[model samples]
Target: MRRRKDKHHANHERWLVSYADFITLLFAFFVVMYATSKADQRKQAEAAAAINSAFQSLGLFQSATPTKQLQGATDAGSAPAATQDETVTPMNVVMGDQMLASPQVQEDFERIKRHLEGLLSNQIARHVVALRIGREGLIISLREAGFFDSGSAVPHPSSLATLGQIAEALRTTPYDIRIEGHTDNVPIHTDLFDSNWELSTARATHLARIFIVGHQFAPARLSASGYAEYHPTASNETADGRAQNRRVDIIVLPRVTTPASPAVHVPAAKPAAIAAAIPAPTATAEATARPLP
Candidate 1:
């Protein structure tokens, strides 16, 4: 008779191998997550440090020691105490809260205004030229009748002396000069100008050229622009109002300080080329004829 076969043993501990592997994988995942979190915190601290340095350089903060101590206190789980030396001035207050120009700039504008008024007394009295402190710094308005002929970009021969005097006065200033040309609501078309856009731009560019070529003004300090029947100073319904609207403005811009950066110089287009590129006005009749209240 054959001997009884040995009893088969069922193993219960085979599942322990799989359980150990799962536990190891879970630990490794948590370790990776902790390392990533620490790296993010490090990056955040670096960015904050950079920003603090910039603010300190701008004179917004009195001292850098306080910022470093504050950061350390924060990391140590403590509230940072405010101190007199750590006070930060508001940016608005530092930059003049209410006025656009500084005290010195305002004084300079006043001086220039007085000088021009004295020299242009006759023109000012005749309403051919006006000087005022406008929102855009000092505005010297030159009416079309005094500076240029009707529908002509060229200044009258008699006006050259006046323009020369004005240029001479401005030549001493350090501020930038912007020559702005304006027109009335009346539409225009001619051999030289196709629309008010061309006429206005041509007038402004011509004045700019005279300042640069004739009076030896710095080209970098001069800019020209044209507003065709838009940005009107008075109503277009009356002749006197229209006369005021048709004018060229010489604006003295306020000086501003900014952080240095790399500059890219681009060649400026000629006035004629710019005018040709500008699209014609497409205002409807209702909008164009609407009277100012």
Candidate 2:
């Protein structure tokens, strides 16, 4: 019995150990994957919250909670019915409502219009000037016949008095003034100008300078632009229409809403000083007025 070594018995249970280890590792791997998925979901929620807060701060989104709730409800397949009152108003609509509700702005516009009508009665009757309330606020149109000679940027000597009067009236108001120069389609090539664009711009700048230097208007409150052969109030096919097209428009812009501060009172310039500051009319400027064809 000693001479014959006992034959080693084959152990069938040894494979069970490796199978148990494999099952444990598989369970652990699933646990780790579940934890990672949960963490990613939490991060995504935090990122969404941060983005919503930023948009809310910018006033681009009214409420973020509603959006999230809507998304959640949609995902759950039970979205709440929207009510008519819950409809979101556009930003432009709200701004328009606020502007319309401003009674002070309307009152100021009406007062200015009435005062200008009274002051410019004579010129209005002669068709040398016109005043109207437009979408852009008050528009005071100065016909070319009353201000500048044909193809000339220099204003007539008589026009300076009228301009001074107008400037005096406007100085008390806080609104900004925009001077726009316009020209007819008739092509122009002159010593001082190459085309209608140059002519129109020169006319606008000249008037702006008169306002800033002669009338002592605040430079910040003034702007100038030129539209040549375009933005025509009347057609360029006839003499009268062409004349109307070749005019300068003074537009008074509405006041902006801001924190209340003491209104600055600029002293009015004397009539004599204003006249002196204006450039003297040239001989060409004094030439007989002729309608542009």
Candidate 3:
């Protein structure tokens, strides 16, 4: 057999790979540059107009007294009279009109905070109970160590008095109450609780029951949710952080005041008046949905 001649094939397509990669990189660079460019002026104006309209429609903006009156008050150095006219317009108005964004509601909220602070001074000093006024509303955080035992949903007997005090303070308010339960990232399995979800829900439900059954809070205004290590305020990698994450938060809904906004007139209604004005209770224990973990 004849010896096979060695054949050499010259490759011409080797450079295409590098060229394609370069084109892809160039396209990505231009895309990034375009994405970072300033937005169009017309678009910005439209966005601003839309936001203002939405706020107005939602009644989030309350117009204060005229500029002349404000100037007069400033010159006189005396507080101007409150402009909030407690005149509920037509009954067809939205329920948002009765929200806790008025001066009276703010006073009530402050009064509640002061009373609770005085009653739970020891717990507050021990860092077991923390009170904060956030945009959502007033938040009362109860640390697990001070409220519940490990793997247990029932709060300690010693903390019952504090809870009772809190209930009494809020008994007369018409704002809705939301009880939230959170846990650390550590996985827990017990006979009573199969997972953190069950544990957290049980804890929140038990606390809500205290308010509903023990304190006779209106079931319509009270609700509960279990976050189950999903809404931690601190890192779960450290001991102290985990401790901080595992807690219960009671959020009073519809902020009483927006310190960021100008002083404006917004009417408020008392609990009894609100109860009479508002329709029947719409919120129920069975209506609350359990979010997937």
How far out, in Å, is residue 262 in model 3?
A: 35
List lDDT for all candidates, in order: 0.71, 0.70, 0.67
List CA RMSD, all candidates: 15.9, 15.7, 17.1
TM-score of 2: 0.58
Q: lDDT for model 1, on a 0 to 1 scale? A: 0.71
Model 1 backbone overlap count = 0
**Relative to the unseen true structure, what is the C-alpha lDDT of residue 273 in candidate 3, on a scale of 0 to 100?**
38
Cα lDDT of model 3 by residue, 177-208, tens digit: 78888999999876666667777777787778
Clashing pairs in 3: none
What TM-score against the true fold does each predicted structure earn? 0.56, 0.58, 0.56
Ranking by TM-score: 2, 1, 3
lDDT of 2 by residue, 178-291 (tens): 888888999998766777777776777778877877766767667787777777898789999998999999977664212233334456566566556666434343222122
2 against 3, candidate with superior lDDT = 2
Please list the residue runs of candidate 1 whose C-alpha ends up more than 4 Å from where it truly belongs after superposition: 1-99, 256-293
The segments of candidate 2 whose C-alpha lies over 4 angstroms from its true place after superposition are 1-101, 256-293
Q: State the lDDT of candidate 1 residue by residue for 1-293, as single tens digits.
A: 99999999999999999999999999999999999999999888878767766754444322313455334435676654544422332221122233245666678889999999999999999999999875556889999999888998777657777787788898778777888888999999876777777778777877887776666676766778788798799999999999999999998766322213322434444434433443332332111111223
Best by TM-score: 2
